[model samples]
Target: MARLRTLFTALTLSSLTHAYIAPISTPSTHIANNDDDDNSDTPLPLIIWHGLGDNYAADGLASVASLAETVNPGTLTYIIRLDDTASGDRSATFFGNITLQIEQVCEELAAHPILSTAPAVDALGFSQGGQLLRGYIERCNFPPVRSLVTFGSQHNGISEFQSCSATDWLCKGAQGILRSNTWSSFVQSRLVPAQYFRDPTQMEAYLEHSNFLADINNERVLKNQTYKKNLEKLERFVMYTFEDDTTVIPKETGWFSEVNGTEVTLLRDRAIYKEDWLGLRTLDEKGALKFEVTGGGHMTLDGELLAKVFSENYGVYGRPFDGQKETDYPREKEL
Candidate 1:
């Protein structure tokens, strides 16, 4: 009896693994036929941008694609795979240039006839991919994307410390560094997030002149002029930040909050706070944005949770592509 039970368990596990590993349907070949006359345009195809050090074959991309499939079955889904190699060395993925990644993404989108001609499409970006997409939207003159949903993306830039915590040694050390202008300047320019960290006093001039974050966020040249306008064009903007994400350092950077019309690092002390800058704050003000904070690590939403977020926030499940108002979908209460 024990042997039989073990065999059954093994079979179940094998079946689950096979299900997860199943090849995703080709988006170009399996286009859905919308028969409903109420809807004018077909549902926009979904393009998924994988996280750093990941590819199309990554399990996380598969899971996200699966979740997208569940939301809009038979709809075409494209996975944007990035080449993480620098020169001939594959191990140089961490040093991969952001501008090149954006160019690659633009090239992929332009190569797709369906995506190029369509008015808008939906995008789901994970981790660094999300930040990359934000840059793409800001800089690229290609087709506009209506909805962009990010999972565990560092919008402001990643930090190595959370708020000043008395109990946490790491947080205390980080606080010490941040409080000192000399030490902060030395370390800040070294980190990726520091490039996009808009200081309250220093303003746009504070950003690293050469970093991708500064360029896309319009800090380097135009500075705040075109940044807000470009972000407000999206119909739906959703961001998910994990509660226990140590990878993004101070997780609030992922949340995108600001005080007195300027971005703020700490959310602890604030009166009027805006949750996002990547058009999400404006979308939220206009009832087009949804920001969710779940209990997990970085980019850890499973297929089920992902589906729930998409359905509840964006209403992609039964939503028609055109003719319906954005207000028709069930809107979540403000954060």
Candidate 2:
């Protein structure tokens, strides 16, 4: 368990180290919206949300944007940024409130000329960014989302807070607050990670104190029908989990499974799905909800896997993202 938690922390903290060291040799110079007359030939605009400890300026993110451009030409790739500068954006990922961050993103996305004018946009979320986009979709989907794809996201919330380095005061400070008083309103509102800390042993506390996940999941007493209604509007929803993901404790969370000791409750069997609180049941029935897996530790993605994802779920003209996309993969089942 200790080793697993350490690995999870690495995914958050050390992943940044990798990004910082390996620089973008030739950064993408193209503007987000380069199309002269957007038409059926052009693919739907793709917006990406970077994970924890990461910003839009990272080389990996640039590579992803470049790859999407290559795989599907005339693709407009937008990487969401909370702050103007890369350093500030990275800092915001650790300490600032996520609810406010999502709100800022909502406004920016809505005000953009290209995104606002377009019919709909597809989303690609990494780690924490995945859930943030979900929150955005559920709370305020101004333009609506055509397709949603997430990699290594904590959709069901995380059991453990990330460990931080000694020198990094911001991450260490957030860790202290999370570990010290996770259920406190102060921590829940201030610390970004605290909002999604769902403990199996503390069900009542989590439902009572969890501001983001519980509200979005409709786990609270008074359910918001709009969240469910808005989510059901998606053309396709895909979630990918790492095959050997030690970084995310209880990896089944990506599939919306509840983990308790040796027992695992798959999403289909859970009341969350059966009840269709978030409208996942609607998606599943229509053959839109896809569950996929990739080989790696945590966010270890290769070109081939990325190409496959982009090709199937995104690009090239009309229709709601080529529903089902691939026939080789079977329907989602217990892991």
Candidate 3:
């Protein structure tokens, strides 16, 4: 029985990886489960962006994409990698190339005859991918994003890896690469507020300024501009976060809360796991529509569990894809 269990574990992980390794192609026409609802346009393809620790080959994007395909067949999905996955060499032009990639994705979708409709192409970015998307939305002025979802992503900035305590739930599992102070420094440097917005006053506006170091509430920038317009009107925004996520813990993670005895009208927005942010309202784009799932590790998102979610919430056909049963995806049966 022990041997059998070991074999199952190995097979399950292998299958999960294989599902994520499949190649990406152009957007395809897919009918929503609610066929009677409205078929005016093809369902917008779902794009899955990989996180920092893992690449397209072995990451959460592939795992989620596998689940999505099973629940909704023919759903279009793509993996956008700013850095090379296998080779750790930094791309000299990672940021610029990423901007180009965003344009290319939109262009590809618009040019596709089957997918060139109002159906909003949604994006789900994991970890740094989420932050990168935020940078794009705030700075590059890419076309309007219909909907956005992020999983275990550090929307603000991540600094908790450097402070991992032995008591923390992630201590044991996050022993190697994640515990590295160097990795933390690398992510921290990338998340400097100036990278996205420049205006010290407008947190979103600061996205324009490339290399300025100023407070979030810069007096000069605030007086300089008022009522800043959103780059792209976001229709739906979802934050799906993992509890006990080691990569970006709550306190040191750069998420801000309201300051006492301060006249600042804009609430000090502190970042939380995507779920807590989503649970606030029926759904608002300011980190709204938060959904929470406890105990799923940073790398593996159980397909069976997400399938259940899709079935219950979205009323979509939630099932296993790629011949791997949903039961096989969960590291723990109860989770």
lDDT of 2 by residue, 1-335 (tens): 34433433443565454223132222244333223244347887999998778888888889888778876677899999999999888867765677789899999999999988888898999887888999999999876788899988889988876555668766665456456678887667756667887879999999988878888889988989999999999878899887777667777778787888778787888999899999998988787888888766677776667776777787743544445533333333423
TM-score of candidate 3 against the unseen true structure: 0.51
| Best of the candidates, lDDT | 2
Q: Which is the leading candidate under TM-score?
A: 2
The list of candidate 3 runs beyond 4 A from truth reads 1-36, 39-41, 83-119, 140-143, 160-232, 251-293, 297-300, 308-335
Least well predicted 10-residue stretch by lDDT in candidate 3: 321-330
lDDT of 3 by residue, 272-325 (tens): 222222222223334333334456444345555456433323321221112211
Considering TM-score, which of the candidate structures 1 and 3 is the better prediction for this target?
A: 1
lDDT of 1 by residue, 121-204 (tens): 777777756777777777663667677888777765543323434565544543454434312443333333334444344544
Better of 2 and 3 by TM-score: 2
lDDT of 3: 0.39
* Global local distance difference test of model 2: 0.76
Candidate 2 ranges with C-alpha deviation above 4 Å: 1-40, 163-177, 320-335
Q: How do these models rank on TM-score, best leading?
A: 2, 1, 3
Residue 98, candidate 3: C-alpha displacement in angstroms: 7.7
